[model samples]
Target: MKPGRPRMKNDEKQNLLSAGDNRHRRTEQEEDEELLSESTKTTNVCVRFDDSPSGLGKTLQTISLLGYMKHYRNIPGPHMVLVPKSTLYNWMNEFKRWVPSLRAVCLIGSREQRNALIRDVLLPGEWDVCVTSYEMLIIEKAVFKKFNWRYLVIDEAHRIKNEKSKLSEIVREFKTTNRLLLTGTPLQNNLHELWALLNFLLPDVFNSSEDFDSWFDTNNCLGDTKLVERLHTVLRPFLLRRIKADVEKSLLPKKEIKMYVGLSKMQREW
Candidate 1:
């Protein structure tokens, strides 16, 4: 008779299944889940905010949730997350906290160090998410573009407002079907800057910068009452904006009271 392969113990098999089931379950807060749903439905999403009411934690959570959801759905990913150098560890920590089941690798440090990671980890597609700084992206465009990214999430997206910048130009080359921009300050300056962001998010839709500029200029010159309304209409579909006061009821506005007291002789002497 042929020898039979050894079977796993009942307890061991149950434990393995339990772990897999936990990873598949949805584990995001309701608001974050709702945001993820909206984000997944659209190709281009702008997460606008005046200030992070939840100290930017919710935004990170939403990103993590999306990554996890994609994994659970069996979507192919080497999702790219671009952030400022200072927040590299923060993003790594966020993924650890929210979705430990999915593997994440941060590509930073010296050129050799990053290259080693690219050879060992990134090229193999072992990681579910790849987090890197904008500087690294500019330097490693060729390597980054080699992958078919599922999603490209940009934090502090205002950095790309100037389309001519090396960073902006380089990132636009990445192959991603979905793009998400996270910014507390979405509109810092002119309308052209806004057009730059829209173009980055939805290149096919906002293909012509000249056309976008002409429309706004024509409307502005006429002093049309519909100018504000028209801008809102265009942005409403793709943008999700939230403020501190709206999301956090416990956070009350700071109150300042002025009081004057004369200094004692001993205090002045000290």
Candidate 2:
């Protein structure tokens, strides 16, 4: 049999994780140490991007960033990635394939199954990142809010365009130090929708919709070149837009293959 790394007993694991529990009381010395350390910690902001062509490696870039933070920056995180239900497994697979060094866990399954996972893995801090579906987050939000996440990433972030959305509201309540929003499409909708994303990223700066509108009034001048340029200037610091053709020249051009098959008589009838 192949040997494996040592595994901790569940009781030992729970005891170790409990030390970092948010509810644990801290001594005055510990608080002072934290205050001193805060100044040296680099603040991470929301990384928002759009206008990228399909297959532009958005997911790959995000995975690499998490890997970098964990391995190089020494920020072995308890990150949370909220993705569409359809892509939950795919994200977990990519994390394992590309950055196996970082422990990635998926919070999924039935209510009973999920509860067991939370008790055994999630609460024990056995993972560096937790990848879960939007629906699962809704169901187990309270459990998630317990962690002070290093990064809160949302795939298909357009789902939170509406500030009033349940997902948006719930995500805003998460105790996360950094956030990343990944979307394949541009914010072609109204400015308010764009503000929703910004608000989630930097609530202090983009706190009021009225204020945002007053600065960039696109109500009557949607096509105003100056307005577009100004908006780009504001977004340049936080946004990164890239195209596959521009950055991925080494990749071969896409090729299509078509196959045709006749349906059986019974299948066609159905």
Candidate 3:
């Protein structure tokens, strides 16, 4: 979980987008063009937010996309988002505040309650999105398996840096085809970290550790051009990254830093 500064809650959930919401309709061509994104053509919107303003604007865009697409196609969603425990709460507060029309169930509660919600209340045929945390997945994997989820989102995915970690291996085992990861540190300090992330992002594309090295060549930290090409070919469409400072440089402060050396008293005397 990451550090957070909480916001005031109004308890008023906004009607962000209505399914089959004909309120603001678009043209067929417009719909088709948007649909070409192909992966996220669901009643929900899933995005990986980077430091970019577009990253922050995903929720609004998701609402817009959902409005345009779900309007064209008569659909009711069980659109789900799985995030960190800390972020899950933020998502709950944000979703309620911004998208009241969309139903969201927070899955970070006690195991009994979560299990109860999963078994009794969260009817896959009826309930909308369920916002859950990764740590809860081990606790609620069986409950999660109940639904044929339209979307899956893993925020701060860098937590799964080690391929050997139970959480890391377990996350990749989930069945959702449409996956979005939101992170500032998508990769660990090393390129192997990138491999672990890519493994989940696109399975078998990188294939094995041998293939990863032949393809990625992270030993020297200089990128393998072919690796970049392969990434563009196989996994390019799914991943989108917007680093901080990409947009709105004016809003943040800019400072130049320099490393300085000081002489010891004996050296100064000499």
Candidate ranking (TM-score, best to worst): 2, 1, 3
TM-score of 3: 0.66
State the RMSD for candidate 3.
12.7
Please give each candidate's TM-score: 0.70, 0.73, 0.66
Instruction: Write down the RMSD of candidate 1 (Cα, Å).
Output: 14.9
Candidate 2 regions off by >4 Å? 1-35, 38-56, 247-270
Give the runs in model 1 whose Cα sits over 4 Å from its true position. Answer: 1-58, 218-224, 253-270
Write the residue-wise lDDT of candidate 3 on 59-135 in tens digits.
44444433332344433344556666766677777767766666667766776777677656575333456777778
Per-prediction CA RMSD (Å): 14.9, 10.9, 12.7
| Alpha-carbon lDDT of model 1 | 0.71
C-alpha lDDT of all candidate models, in order: 0.71, 0.76, 0.56
Question: Which candidate has the top score in TM-score?
Answer: 2
lDDT of model 3 at residue 83? 68
Candidates sorted on lDDT, descending: 2, 1, 3
Query: What does the lDDT come to for candidate 3?
Result: 0.56
